[model samples]
Target: MAKTLEFAYETPQEVKVGDDETTFTLVCKNEGLPVDLTTAKLITVKIGSRDGYLREQPISIDSLSKLPTGQFKFNFDKDTLDNFPTGSYFLEVWVADDQGTSIYPSGNPLNFIVTANIENSSGATITTIAYDDFVKELNKAASTIVKGDKGDKGDKGDKGDKGDKGDTGATGIQGPKGDKGDKGDTGTTGPQGPQGATGPTGPKADKGDKGDTGTVDNAGLISAPAFHSLQTQVNNSAVGTNLITNSNFSSGLDHWKVNPGANSDCKAVVTTDSDGDTCIHITGTGDACGLYFGPVSFNQNQVTTASVLAKGIGTIWWIGLQSRPFSNFGTISTESYSKIGSIMQADSSSDTFCVYFNPVNNVVDIYIKFAKLELGSHATDWCPNSAEILTQSDYAKIKAAIVALGGSLS
Candidate 1:
């Protein structure tokens, strides 16, 4: 008996583009007597478009002599559908006798779809119909073409009329001016304005009248006393009496006297005569008697009563022997009186005592007097001719001396 063969077209239902090529199996099963099918040289596979026209080329499964259990597979190159558009195509498998002389009815025809609509690749298509039902639904009358819903229509409107022409009325009189507007708000300050031009010179003013002179004071012009006046209250006291009385050394002597001895030593003696009148008598001669009155205490070896008496007598005779005048007498020295150290006689009588005058005090009145000739030989021309005699030069010297003594001579 002849062998009966069964076949199937096996390809994936869905595949992506550019994947490995698909394999279609043309399965054959041996159901009758064993046949030497190894002699068959070719098994044919026919692919067609969905329109039912056969493809111009057919793929052959070769090497059937090595076919086992009557099964065969053919792997078509993936480039087979490179130029085809994305759509469904068809595959058909058939077989023929090894001699190519007759068709075999032993293998039933098998069908598959060549789907260019890749599963997930770009440009692939998605349809609601199942892949198996695609060809049937594509042929259905009402389902073949799909239409989208239509959009709504727009409304219409009426046309506008032309505007009326304006009237040409007489020109009315000009309206009254409007009320003044409110002041505008201040804006941001601008740059400072330029400096203003200089103003014109003004006319010269009249001279003002002179003012009255103020009253003049004569006190400054008057001389300050050589000695301050003894206060009237102090003068009335016993202290004042003691100061004046102790200053006097002799009652017969009306004023203090200075008599310097030849040895340059001196003595200052006070004498109260029987009449209770007082006097100061000095005896001796030298420079030691130059300073007669001062705050200094006398040492017994340096100062004697005679030297003090000579200086006191010299001062008194020159200035009328006023107590206040002699108060500052210590400033006199041999340098100031060297020209007139000898006692000066006021008269030609040899019995007359020699004396000195305070030339600065106008040389008036007797200031000091020596006793009779027993007193000593007078140092030549040492005395003034009279109590009132004073040269202009002597007055000047005395004035300067008072000033040197810190007394105001003015």
Candidate 2:
């Protein structure tokens, strides 16, 4: 195929030695269209000089979705840049796809400079001499010293007289404490007076008559029909909202399928939660017990959030044709229901997406409820399927409304 891959990166790409957390954001296209990065098995950025190679760093798998559309980031840590010296280097993005390996820029590679840090560049040039040369110079200096240096020991002079010794100093004493003062006298107490006489009691009053009971009006309260109407409205609103089919497993794994790779010991069953609500219980021992709901339709570059009311630890993954965005909820309480979710953006080829559930380990027991996969960056309240939300009364009300509006029904 002709050269179709094009790469563009942000500028100010200079880096300092010993620096960490350096990043390069790159946007790629193929034939003037955004390239799907998730399709590649591996993507790496190689840094090298004209002489040879320096270092190569791969993009982190988890953070790929955190970037904007058609963009990928290559992060360099302290260890990678610490080895680089002050010099100019060339970098190329290498992608390994199903077709073959390809490098970006179809022409010359991009240039990036690694400047010297203060700790590495402050000293001047240092010179070193050979050991044999130092030995030869030492021998020549030793030969120049003569044996006539022993005649200076003949002149000894007399010493001067000593002075008189000084007297010893006396010790000092601490001062005495002052005397305490006398205390003052207390005041006298006052005399007590005589008590007054008590007054006479009044007559008792009569009790009043009992009041009548108030009546309760049950007509204004929500009846079975009214409740069914409200519930139908809620479910109808959420009919086509959730991307995943049978997300809550209310139909006992009707639309979910067990992963073929999961261990044979894994088991899934319809169970009830502590609150008497329906849920799916998955359990296994010694291997991954996984299930998935797939082929969920999504728009290009659409952002979606997936959530689950769960008890016990597990990993939730939003699997797309070219991207996998996942989050682990380890702090889920076994004693009560806990909500866990993850937000991800779909790639250009993201029409096919899947919601995958994997237990933290093979030896597992988990209760799952309200499994929701919906469009938008945040999760909303959970609702049942449209078919399951309506009761017989709800259908009757809909027919009545249609009839009153002069609409015909079969």
Candidate 3:
């Protein structure tokens, strides 16, 4: 396939692992001339190893230089280097504009080398201690010191300044021909007074008649009917209700079946993505092939929905139903994990669900994750089967609750 943009870099150079000062420069070109990057919305470098995409770092638009030539410079900082061991790596520069995203140097990914750091290769042994441990050791050493003589007391602090005096009150209302009396000094507290004699006790009254006894229903225990109802509700909860077994493919291909056409090179396997997330990686060329889910059950006119995160192009289809030949989600192509879904009302025909890729005769490369199938018309987030999520202890507690409520598990 022809790429819209081209990227040329300084002659392939090797950088020592952990070398932060070294920089790598790439010049983006349209046709053979340098492209003006000022108008571009985003420029990013996707770094990866032979395994897959590891990380992406954005290049600031201000950093684009057009002086002698248009280019951007980046370095292998600690964070990016930490994800890489001493080995070969590749990167692709992505340039985006109002048109769309364009990947550069489409021929082959730009390659670079990472060699082992000198310190690592030297095999030097360095001993280190935790700060807390070092502090403890210093305290242990200080314990052997002799006691010092007591110091003399410090001088007392000076007295604080006195507060200002209050203003005199206004003259009292004029009295009617009366002279004012002198104020008397405060009197001393008086002695405690003697206790008074107790009064005579009152006569007791007769007790009232006892009340009637109340009826006890079930002795305050849970009734069998209520317990059964609770048991039914607990069973109906979403816990063990996901219809797609091996939804995440974390269990390899336990519940999945491969349907490869004659002479088809298609196959699916469980693999981890760049972020260490589990997904199904499907790759093949030539004839069409697919990954199928079930001849599982479904009811007439029941709304069933299925969804899966995918990259590349493919279609999810429902077969073995009364709906003509089959029903399928519209064709979808994506460069990243995108959720694709299909909704259908079932007929009594069959319940087989298949995800078709590579169709007829074409190349197929895609990834799938977190597939889900449920009864609602709307697709929901992926969830594992109850056996994968419910722990034995949790189930035990639930069982005990049911038993205590006078219910029995079938």
Candidate 4:
């Protein structure tokens, strides 16, 4: 089996979902004559579920070029890699160098899996698998059940007879009787004992002597701190409290800008809501279009909750943080007034913590409002901005207020 065309994945035995690209390095192993460029026909790399490998040769690659060091590189697109589902996959490399093309092994097919990135949760939902994946799994499992040699027949054993009943044992003293059972349910009163002759009227008893007034003395005691029970006030102001600038779109599209790839047709404008609210409306015709607000101060490695309210036409739009699309919460379908959100690990690859949107298509207008990006793994209520909430003066004011009120908060 000259199936010995050696190749190795850059990250052996594992591939992540969101990786921009993955590569397989092919080391020339064909010892055939005329090893130079002219005789080197092509080296193909084909992948299939481990099950599919049992039935076919590798798919043909259009061509393979050699590096100065005689190593050929195979690059796989991760964006579209999701076309294959989660599970093991078999990667086969066959060379048609001057020697000859590789042939199948008589016993087992050569294969391995490009496993789902179980540890990298950022790309949790990308999916693809063979049409008969379940069936293949079942067959693969069944074929692994090799039977062991049979055990020697066991020796027969003898039986024993039953014993006779034993004599009764002597009685022990009885326990004290249990408390008498509750009085039996009362019997109905007998018909007013046949009206006995009326008894003479008894004289009314004299009023009892007045009872003495009772008195008790109270003593000192420790008491728990009294809770004021003041209700937490709601901050209904949507002017400027949010960490995101122009998040409410009240400043129109001031803080928002087009990402690098936007064309002139892909532009944003402030539009009035059908219910009379203001929002940033994006419309255009391009393979991709987007609006982003960011470069805000935030640290990656910490998880955060990001969200936005979107309404308009189209199957879906992206929502989440982005540092050059390095991370996304996935897509949200804008079939209605969708309030989309996700919790993500801040992608530290870039410092930009952006609220981004990319419509599925540009045929219709897309409306977005209240884009919020904040630290923490869970979303809190939409607390709008209030007077430069992050300023030193405001911070001091807030701390002073808390301290003045005798709050224990640090």
Q: Give residue 41's lDDT in candidate 2 (0 to 100).
A: 82
Mark the regions of model 1 whose C-alpha exceeds 4 Å error after superposition. 1-20, 29-37, 56-62, 65-67, 83-108, 116-410
Q: Candidate 4 on 266-287: residue-level lDDT in tens?
A: 7678888876878777666543
lDDT of 3 by residue, 18-100 (tens): 67887776655543345677777998888887688888989888876543345677787676675567765677889899999
lDDT, residue 202, candidate 2? 40
How do the predictions measure up, each by TM-score? 0.23, 0.36, 0.36, 0.34
Q: For candidate 1, give the lDDT.
A: 0.34
lDDT, candidate 2, 300-333, per-residue tens: 4445556677776543332323253322222346
Query: What's model 4's overall lDDT?
Result: 0.48
RMSD of each: 76.0, 35.4, 25.7, 27.8
What C-alpha lDDT values do all the predictions have?
0.34, 0.56, 0.59, 0.48
Supply candidate 4's per-residue lDDT for 368: 74
For model 1, residues 76-126, the per-residue Cα lDDT tens digits are: 545655544443444433445645633332332222323444343455565
Candidate 2 vs. true structure, TM-score = 0.36
